[model samples]
Target: MLILKQLILGLLLPAVVGGGIFIFAKSLAWKKESEQKKARLSGWLVAVALSAGYTVGYTGLEGLPPFPPREGVHWLCYLSIIGLISGAFWHSSRWGRLIVQIALSIVIPRLLLNSAFKYTWGQFEGIIWWMCLAVAVFIFWHIVQESFTILPAGGSSPFVYFGLSGGTALVLAVSGSLRLAQHAGILVAIFAASWVITFVRQRSDNNKWQVFPLGASPVVALLLLGIWMNGYFYEEVPAASAILLAIALFLAPVGRIEKIQRLGARRSAIVQICVIALPVVIAIGIAVARSGLFGESSSY
Candidate 1:
């Protein structure tokens, strides 16, 4: 019963709401280009709505306390909602977009650290970790955003990226923590449904493939947050293994490699898959070895 409720509230409701918004936005604009912008906005709406729905579904409305000391989930839900609103209006200005991304980069990592380690702001180690995480997230944001501009139309679709993310979520679920895995499952549903809507709308207009940060940001946040939780809170998964898995995800952009980029899309994708898989395999091996699932004598 709980699972059914979560599926309906977390997955079904958000998909309907997001799809409805996309269709309505399309109706409001007569021009194809204008409709594309609206579509992007609708994607942002889906990301925010999904985040909110997952929060409410997973942790009841009352689960979140007032403020000051917020949980990791609260930070994810609230920052995502606030960031979506700010991004919608501020996307036109370069500086505004940068400021918003930077704020989220700092806040998300700090919130995770607090939730996991319960470290005070005055602690030097905590501060250093926060700074490092913030920088890593900022770099990831830039990489994803840049991919939209760098990749040719239809070269690498958002669906592919989202699918990769979902796979990572599944991996985390199996090897790390079940609770975090559930959240990742919800995220997969959200992205999959939202991607379908965007793909259909683009097909109707014959538009080129493009993925805005609006759709990508929340997935990035969920992936990073899930990894952190698994590494710090879950005992089965080593912190180093989690970090390696997170780093492996970045290999999707292997097309950027000059030699690889020279290959056709089909070949490039194959290479990218190999690149991404190698590290994931290594991470999983490390986790299994560390866990001593096979035998006590196994070491690596």
Candidate 2:
């Protein structure tokens, strides 16, 4: 019953909010290319807003009030606001988009690392290790951003990615923190709902598919944060496996896969599914092995 409630709230509530934003954007005149661009930006802004509100509300419900030490939630809220504001300027200038990307790169890694160190590890050590992790996260974000940018506009690939994130959340829920998993589920629901409506409206208008930082940034950030928190703090998942899973998730954008790249969207999506599944299978196998060992040791 509790799971059902979380699923509905996590999925349904954000869907409504996202759907509303899509409707409003579609209702606009958008006669000029500039107007259409702004409309699309506005939709992303709404996505960020939904993400922030849902994060705050979800965490609060879990008895973690919006306060210090719960810095992860606060950082998410801050990122969403900054993303929405910065994203508004994205369509106006190249410098604006670059600024937003840089801001996210700086803030998100710091936030996730801080949360992991403070809440899970209890102290920040190994400066070189920390730097390496931060660098990896930044690179991963860049790859995801590039992936979204290159995907055929109006293509449903992004939605598929979002759905995969939700699946990741469910896996975490079973193996790690339920609260974090619920938050991830909510993020997926919001984005998925918004994407469907936006795809349909844009199809009707014949608008090219474009990527918005506001929507993609938080989703990726939240997913990485969840993985780190679950692996380090909860210790339900093995840290090495979690790190490998994170690395694998970002590998989908590697352009070296010539055979997969040549295929059409439908075939390409199938290839992506196969690529994503490989790491997930490995991670799950590691997790299961660890759990079995722990169980045997405990029985002793």
Candidate 3:
């Protein structure tokens, strides 16, 4: 009974409410042209509604007259809801929407669900979990399906938003002690490659990315991952690490292609290096410090 209630409250409720807003936004977009404006409004509405309702439910509602409260696992569940709402609010483009839904569907739920597994079942249970990872894979496949459209230049592409979030997660992971962090780092690298592919496509058709939302995905990824992981990783990001992640995320694209010769584009290499390297260094430092590999705790 409790598990059923939780599933409804955590997954179904947000999907219904948030999905309704998305559908409405789609209708509005079809009627009008300025997708950005409509997207902004829809994003704001979804964010506010989800955040407010989540706060109320987690704090007051939950289990009728309310028992004491489930501890860590339940908190992750609630945070996943918050992350979903925030993702919807943060992204503007259609691709961004698709990527966010993928993250919400897979990353957020898995983080919480995995933690639940650790508590309920002994050990990390990777094999069984891998089987369960069908959920994340399904979400990823759907993201590819719903969002992929031919870029101006060549082939179909996954949304830039997915690349952004995945990249951010990888950067943060590079900065931590966990092996998952390294995998995240690799994913970011792959995503970066894909971003370059997109840039090439856009440039070929003379459509440069005029403005990029810099901090939204990375920041949100960190926040959501942090909350989901119970603050396990990236507790301390070095100044250099933070700067590098920022640069890598911020620049890199224009650096590769001279066609994108905007002011920001000019400094692409520097930014890209900083974005990729700074956070990684910081994360390593933190790991060493925590493990006392260096002196009595090196500040990451």
Candidate 4:
């Protein structure tokens, strides 16, 4: 009975919430009153299934041999639930909507992992890793897309929010665990700066061609600043690189004036950043804690 309760609460909530949202969205798309909107929604759903679903499925399918049955089952459940929520949010371009999606898809899983990390060996893989990879890819693609166009010369796309929130959470964890609060706090502050600058630039629609200071080019400059900081402290390949690349790609393509402006509408800053950062940070924290810092394996 206790096992049943734990299973229902731990696994069922996500499955139901994620599946319910997706089904509801599909239902709305199919309704006659919203056919036009529905059509667009349908197209996005298909695209998401293709893009997000393909990643989830590929990771499971390709990584099957070594994965245990219990682990595989857990991953399938997580992947399906996450994909559903992400697909729902990715369907819209609004910041609020995207934030909700990221909360459901990325934040929940991270919380779960954190909890497990405290209680047990707390290791997880399968869908969690795939979702991280998928979200990272999605953010990178948008960063590159926005860099040449919609973003002002040194401005970043809205994806920096994830860097701020997720990166801060990561710093907090490492700080608490490794007794590196000063260093972690500094990194978190830098991430916040990146988010603020990116948000302002996004709101203003700035697109100048010169490298501004940290605030001037928050997306590119701040991200690089964060990456440099992380690389200095943490030996892990800084997951913040996606945002940094987006910054560089945009700056490099600024010379193609006509090509840059045509990049079209951008995604919200909050959702994209959360999607990109949350999973990677969670994975890194867990992997580091369990595997031991500096690449040494735990005797346990």
Which of 2 and 4 is the better model by lDDT?
2
TM-score of each: 0.73, 0.72, 0.35, 0.28
Clashing pairs in 4: 148-260, 149-260, 152-206, 152-207, 153-207, 153-208, 158-269, 162-273, 162-274
Q: Candidates 2 and 3: which is better by lDDT?
A: 2
Give the TM-score comparing model 1 with the true structure, all chains together.
0.73
Misplaced by over 4 Å in model 1 are 15-70, 115-122, 151-156, 197-208, 213-219, 226-236, 288-300
Ranking by TM-score: 1, 2, 3, 4
Candidate 2: tens digits of C-alpha lDDT, residues 48-167: 545554554355345444645355544544444555555455456667666656666555555655756555453446355466665665676666556565444553445645655665
Q: What overall lDDT goes with each candidate model? A: 0.58, 0.56, 0.40, 0.37
lDDT of 4 at 145: 30
lDDT of 1 by residue, 1-300 (tens): 977876776667655654455345434433446655765665565445555545543443225544664555445455545545664554466787788778878877766566444644557777787788788778777765555555445424445555545655555554546655555555566557657766776678677444443454544454445445544544355665667666765776677788997898668767776676677667666766766667762433
As for model 1, its CA RMSD to the true structure in angstroms is 4.2
User: Candidate 1's C-alpha lDDT?
Assistant: 0.58
lDDT of 3 by residue, 1-300 (tens): 865754455444543443444334334434656766654554454343334333333332233322222443244335534555554555546677556655655554445455456555545565466445545334333432222221212211223433433544443443353333432323233333334444664677566432112112322343334332432322344444443333332332333454433435335534444443444445445544554545575444
Residue 200 deviation, candidate 1, in Å?
5.4
Task: Residues 124-220, candidate 4: write the lDDT tens digits.
Answer: 6545553763464345434433443433333343233234334443533443323222222322333343334434544565543211211112122
Q: Count backbone overlaps in model 4.
A: 9
Candidate that would win on TM-score: 1
Stretches of candidate 4 off by over 4 Å are 1-35, 51-56, 59-81, 89-99, 105-109, 112-300
Task: Give per-residue lDDT, candidate 3, residue 107.
Answer: 57
